[model samples]
Target: MSAELTRLAERVADLERRLSATTRTARLAYSSIEDGAIEVYDNDGTLRGSIGVQPDGTVGMVAVNAPPPPAPAPALVDSALAGLDVSWDGQWANDEDTTPLDLALVQVHMTALADEELSEETMVAALVPGGGRTGVATGTYEPMWIILVAVNTSGVAGPPSAPVQGQARRAASDDILNGAITDLQLAEAAVTEAALAAAAVGKTAIQDGAISTPHMVANSIQGDRIAVGTLDGDRITARSITGSQVIAQSLTANELAANSVTALQLAAGIVDATHIKAGSLTAGLLAADAINGKVITGSRLQTAATGRRVVVDPERAEVSIYSGIAEEMQPGGLHADVLDLGASKQAGVSLSAPSLGKGTAYLAMQSPNTTGGAGSIRLEPSDRITEPGYTYLLARQGNSTTQELIESYASAPSGGKITVQQQTSAGFTWRTGTTSATLRDGVLSVPNIAVGTARVTPVADKPTSFRVAKRLEGKEVRAFVTASTTVPGTVVEVAATDADNTGFTLWVTRTNATATNVWWLMIGSDA
Candidate 1:
C-alpha cells in the first residue's frame, strides 16, 4: 500500500509540473480580442512580452527582461514624416514610469521649410503608450521638423530625435516645366494675358489663324491693337456698339458713316446747339412735333436786338425788344424798356391811342394852338417839323442832348374877330392889342390891362343895365376892374363873386352917369 501511494504521489507531482508549464504558456498567449494583441506579465504585473498587429497593419513582437531600475528619461533616435503628422522611435521606455510618463515632457519644433523662414517651438501632450511608436506632432505645410525630446516623471530629459525633412508639392508652373503637362493638357481658355510673360506670344510666336475669335478671350483686345481704318462700315454690325462701350467724346464727324447718325442712335440730350452746324436745321427739315419744349430752349431763338418784328399769331405782329414784345410806342417809336405801375399810371406823362385804326395814334407831346386844333408828334413815321429860326409850339428835351419840336402852331392872341386869311412868308402870327396873356394848365394869367374910353359902346344890346359875365370852374376867382375915364360927379364900382362851380358873377355899378367904360380881368382855372 505504501509503495502504491508513493507512485501515486510521483504521478501527481508530474501532472502538477505539466499543469504549471501549461499555465506559463497560456499566460504568454493571453490576448486582447479587440486588438489581437498577446501580452505576458510577470508576477509583479510588469510588462515582459508583447506580440500584436501594430497600428500600421504589420505584425510585431517584443521580448523584454524584467525592466532595469528606473534610468534617465529615454531619447528619440529617428523620425519619419507623413503630411503634417510625425512619427518617431527612440530609447524612451523606462520601468520607473508607467507609459512614458504620467506627467511627461513632449516638445515639438515646427519650422517653415521653404518660401518662408519661420520657426516656433511648443510643448505637446505625450501620446498614449508613448515610446518607440509615438505620434510626435503635426506641423504646418512644407514643414521641416526638429529633434524631439521628452522628460519623464523624474524630470529627466531625453536625447533629441533626428530631424524629419519635407517639402511642399510642386506648383502647376513647375509641373509644366518638368514635362508633366503640355499645351493640349490645359483646359480651354486656361491661359490668360496676366499669366503670360512680358512680350510673350508675340505675332511671330503665333501660327497663322491659330488665334481666332474662339481662341481669343473677350475684351482682351485693346484699342492700340486695332489699326486705324481697319474697321469699315461693313465690318461693324448696325447698333452693335452701345453708348457705354464707346468712350465719351471719342467719335468725330469724320468717324461716323454717312447717314449713320440719327436721333435714335444718339444718346438723349447729347446733341446741343454747339454740336449742330449753323443752318443745318430748317423749318422744312423738321417733322411735325419732332421738337419738344424740353429739347429746344425757346430763349435760344430770342434776338436781343430791338425793332425786329415777331409774328406771334396770325392776327398780329409785334416789335421785339430783347426777346420780348414792346408794350408801348412813344414819339420815338416802340419803347424797349417798360416800367410796371401795378394798376396805376407811372409815366411822367403818358399818351395812349384812342383805338386801333389808321388814323388812331398816340403822341407823347402836343402843341396848343389858339387859332386851330392842337398839333402833335407822330411815332409811326417818326416825323417832326424842323423850323430853325421859327418858334415851335412844343419842345421835348431828352437826356440834355437832343431836343425835338413836335409841331408849329398859328396863334391869335386876342378874342376872335375873323379876318381875311392870308399867307405870309413869316407864317401865321398874331399880336394882342395892348393885352397879353399866358395860358398854362387851363388857367389864364393877365399881367397888365388897359382901359379905353369910347362912347361906352356895348357890343350887345341889353335892358337898362347889364354886366358881362364869365364862366369859371374853380374855388374862386379874383377880378381887377379899371375905369376908362374918371369924370367929376360920377362913381363906378365892379365886384366879382363865386358862382356854382361853373362861373362867377360880376357886378358893375355907376351913379350919376349915363354910361361908363371899363376894362375887366379875371383869373381862375377851368376844371
Candidate 2:
C-alpha cells in the first residue's frame, strides 16, 4: 500500500508541473476546447487526444480574458452659495428664491468666530481612533466624505430644511425637517462637503453702529435722513418732565432750580434759571407751548400759606424750598415701599391713592371718582375671576414667576376665633405664632415678610393637622427678589382657590434643613 501511494503522489506532482508549464492560446473560430487537460514534459511528453508536430516544437500560450471595464468616477455636486452677506430691515418677507428647502446653513459671525474655525472635520476624525486585530483593520475613512441629516416639514407647517450637523432648531411652528446620512459611505461625503463649505466663507458680520448720523447717510430724504457732509454739531435742548413720568426716560434731574433749563427749549438763547412764580408749579411738563407760555424775570421764588408761588422780594421771609414728599404714614419719610396712587401736586407730600378721580387727577377735580397715575399693584391672570368687585393680587415667594394657590382652614378648640402663626428662621419666637403679630390695620393682616407675598383664604373648617403650619422654602435653591434681594429664609407665600363655597384646596412646597430635592413636600388645604 505504501509503494502504491508513493507512485500516485509522484504522478500528481508530474502532472501539476506539466500544466504549469503549458499555456495554450488557440483561435480558429470553429475549434474550441472544453473541460480539457494539458500535460507537458521532456521531448518524450505523452499525448492523449490531439498532437501538434513541428520542426522546432510547439510554443504554448493561453487566451487571456480582457479586464472588466472600470466603473465611472463619482460625480461631484457643485454648490451655489460659497460666501454670503445678507441684511434686512424691520419689515422683511420670505424670499422664496434664496431660502433653502432642505439644506442647513450654520453661521458664525465675526464677533463670535472665524471662517477656518468654523469647519469641524479633522477635529472629529482625530477623535475617532481606528485600529483592530490586524495592524490597520479599521482603516481611516476617506477625508472627502461629509455626513448629514435632513428632514422636511414644509408640507406639514414650517419651511423644511436639512440639518448640516446636529443642532436643535425651530423655524415655523409646524415645519420640521428630518434627514440623515444612514450609511458610512454617505456620511463620509456629506460631512467633508460641509467642512469645505464652512471653511470657504465662515463668519457672519457684526453690527457696526445702531444709530448713524445724517452725515453718515448720503441720500437726502425728509424724515430723520441727512445728506453726507451736511449734518454738523449735536442738537441740545432743555426739557422738563413731571408727574408720574418715568424718571429713567424722563427728567434728567429730580428738580430744576437755578441754572435749571427746565422751562427753556428750542428757543435756544443761553437763558438760565426758571423762577417759580405762580399757581401750582408742581414740576409740570414743559412742552413746546408751555415753554412759550410763562416768562420769568428773576431767579428767586416765594410761597404763601395759601400754597401760592410769588416772585421773591428778597425781603419776604417765606421763600422756603419745600423739598420732596414727607410721609405721614411712617417716619423718616419711609413707609413699607408705599405705591403712589394720588393726584395731589403737593411737594413734600408722598401721595397715596384715595382713589384718584379720572381727569380730575390731571386738571382740577372733574369726576368724583377714578384716577390715572403710575402705581404698583399685583396682577393675577385668570379666566374665572368672575366676582363683580373682586380682583386678585398675585404674590410670588420664590424666583419662579408662578404663584400657586393655597387654601387654609382652622377651627376653634373651644369656640374662639382661630389664629395661626408664621414661623421664621429662628423658629417660633415671641409673637411668631401669635395672630396679633400678623394682624394689621384692624384686619386679619399678613406679616411684613422679607418676601411679602400671600393670599388669605378665610377658613370654613380647620385642617386635620391644625397645628401643623408650614415653613416654606425650596428643595433646590431658588432666589426671591424682595425689595432688593435676600437669602433662602426670606421667602414665604400663601395661595388658595375656591370652586364651591363648601371647601377649598391648598398647595405648597415645604422645604427641609438641607437644600436638596429630598425634602421637597407638597401639601394641600383640607378646609
Candidate 3:
C-alpha cells in the first residue's frame, strides 16, 4: 500500500505541473494595461515571469531556476488611439515612490524612438501603459518601469455661447474671446486720442446745417465760416468780404477798419440809401464821386470854364433852382458822367431829339415869346441867335463842325419883321441880312420862313413912303414907324412887334403895279 500511494502522488504532481504550465502560458498571452508599466505573474501569481514593458520596449520574464515556458508567440496588442485606459497592476503593486524615475525616462525615450517618423504632434504623447493615463505617477511596472502619459481628464466639450444645447459651444467661446480681445484693444486706443483737445473744438464737425447767427466779434474760429467775424476796428485791419455787417462807428475816427466792409454789404446799403461813413478821413474813405449816394438826378453839369462840374440837361432833364427853369445850365459845355441808380426808370436823366446828324445837341433853348407855345423850340427872324450856339464859318456844308440849325418863324400879318430870338448863353450873336438866304456855319441856310416886303420904293437909291400894317390873328399892330429906303435887289423885311394893322403889301396899288412892283406880304397866325 505504501508503494502504491507513492506512485499516485507522483502522477498527481505531474498533472499539477502540466496545469501550471498551461495557466502560465495563458497569462503571458493576456494583454496588460497599466497605470505606468504593468506586470503579469504566472499561476498562483508568484511573479515567476513578468509581462511588463521593459526599457528595451520588449516584454521581459525573469527566468529563475525553474522550467521555462515556451517563448511567447508574436503578440498583437489591441492598441487603439481611442478610449485608452490604464490601471495599476493590482496583485503586487509597489508604492508609487518605489518606481524609478529613470524607468519613466526610459519609456519616454522609447516613445520618442517609436514616433521618430512622426512630427512633434504624435511624439508629444509618451509611450507606456501609463502613457494612456499618467506615466509612472501612481503604480506598477515589472517593479521598475514607468511611463509618461497625457491623459484627457476633460471629456468632449464644444464651442461656447452659453446655450448649452449646441454642438460646438466650447470652441465658439474660445474664438469669440480672441475676437473680442482684439476689438477691445482698438476701441481703447481710439478713445485715448479724442480727449486731449480740451480748450475748444479742434475742427468743425458739421453735424447738420451750419449756424447762421452772427459770430462773436472776439473769438477765433475753429473751422470754416458762413460769414466773417473780427475784433473791433481797434484790433486789426480787414479785407472787405460780402455778407459782413458792421456795427462800429465812423471809419475816419477809430471805427471800422479800412476796406473792412464787404462790397456786397455796401451794394445793399446803396440801394436802401442807408447812410454810412466810407472810410478814414485821411487815407481810405471813398472819393466824392465814388459812392452812388442818395439817388441824385439832374442834367449833365456845365463846367463854368473855370470852376466845378454842373448839371446841363437842357431839353428833358429840368433843374428848377427855385421854382422856375434856370436858363443857362446846359449839357454841351460839360459832359455827363457817373450814375446813381434812378428812383424810377426815368430817374436817369435822358435827353433825346430827332436831328439830321451826329452832333451833340445838349441843352434845348427857348425864348419867352413864340408863335407857338413855351415848349416850342423856335427862332424868329427879328430875334438874333447868340452864344454857346451860333458861329459863322465859310461854306463847307458836309462838315460836322458847322452844325446847321434851322429855326422857323413867320411874319406877323400886321407886318412884324420875322422875329429871331437869341439863346441866353453868353458871348454869341446872330442877325439876318437883307437876303432870303444867309451864309451860316459853313452853309447857305435858306430859312423856312417868309418875310413881308419893306414898303420902300423900288426906284434907284430912293425911298417911297407907304403905309405898312402889322396884324396877328386878325388884330392890327402899329409896327412900322417910317418910310424905309432899300438898295435894288435886296430882300427887305419889316422888324416890328406891333399887332395893329390890316393885310399889308409894298404898294397897295402902285401907279406902276407890276408883279415886282406890287409887293407880297406874308400872312399867318404868327403875324
Task: Report the lDDT tens digits of candidate 3 across residue range 246-282.
Answer: 4344234455577665664355444332443444244
What overall lDDT, based on C-alpha atoms, would model 3 receive against the true structure? 0.32
Q: 2 or 3: which has the higher TM-score?
A: 3
- Give the alpha carbon lDDT tens digit for every residue of 1-527 in model 2: 99999999999999988777664433454674332323232333222122232212453332111121211111122211221122111110233333233222211111111123222211221100111111111111111222211112211112211212111122343353454335653643365534665457333432556435532333333435557766444442224222322335555555546675553332444332453345634546545576575766545554543322232433332223323233222111111222232322211212122121211111111111122221222332221233232223322122111122221222233222222322333322122223233433333422321122222222223211111123332232222211111345422322333312222233232222221111112322322
Task: Note the residue pairs that clash in candidate 1.
Answer: none
Q: Write the per-residue lDDT of candidate 1 for residues 43-116, one digit (tens) a residue.
A: 86444555785434667765544332232233332433423344444333353444442325455544434222
Q: Local error of candidate 3 at 323, Å? A: 21
Q: Cα miss at 331, model 3 (Å)?
A: 14
Q: What order do candidates take by TM-score, descending?
A: 1, 3, 2
**Model 1, TM vs. native:** 0.24
Model 3 misplacement above 4 A: 1-261, 264-267, 270-283, 287-316, 319-377, 380-527
Q: Which stretches of candidate 2 lie over 4 Å from their true place?
A: 1-267, 271-527
Poorest lDDT segment (10 consecutive residues) of candidate 1: 414-423
RMSD of each: 59.7, 36.3, 64.9
TM-score to native of every candidate shown = 0.24, 0.14, 0.15
lDDT of each: 0.44, 0.27, 0.32
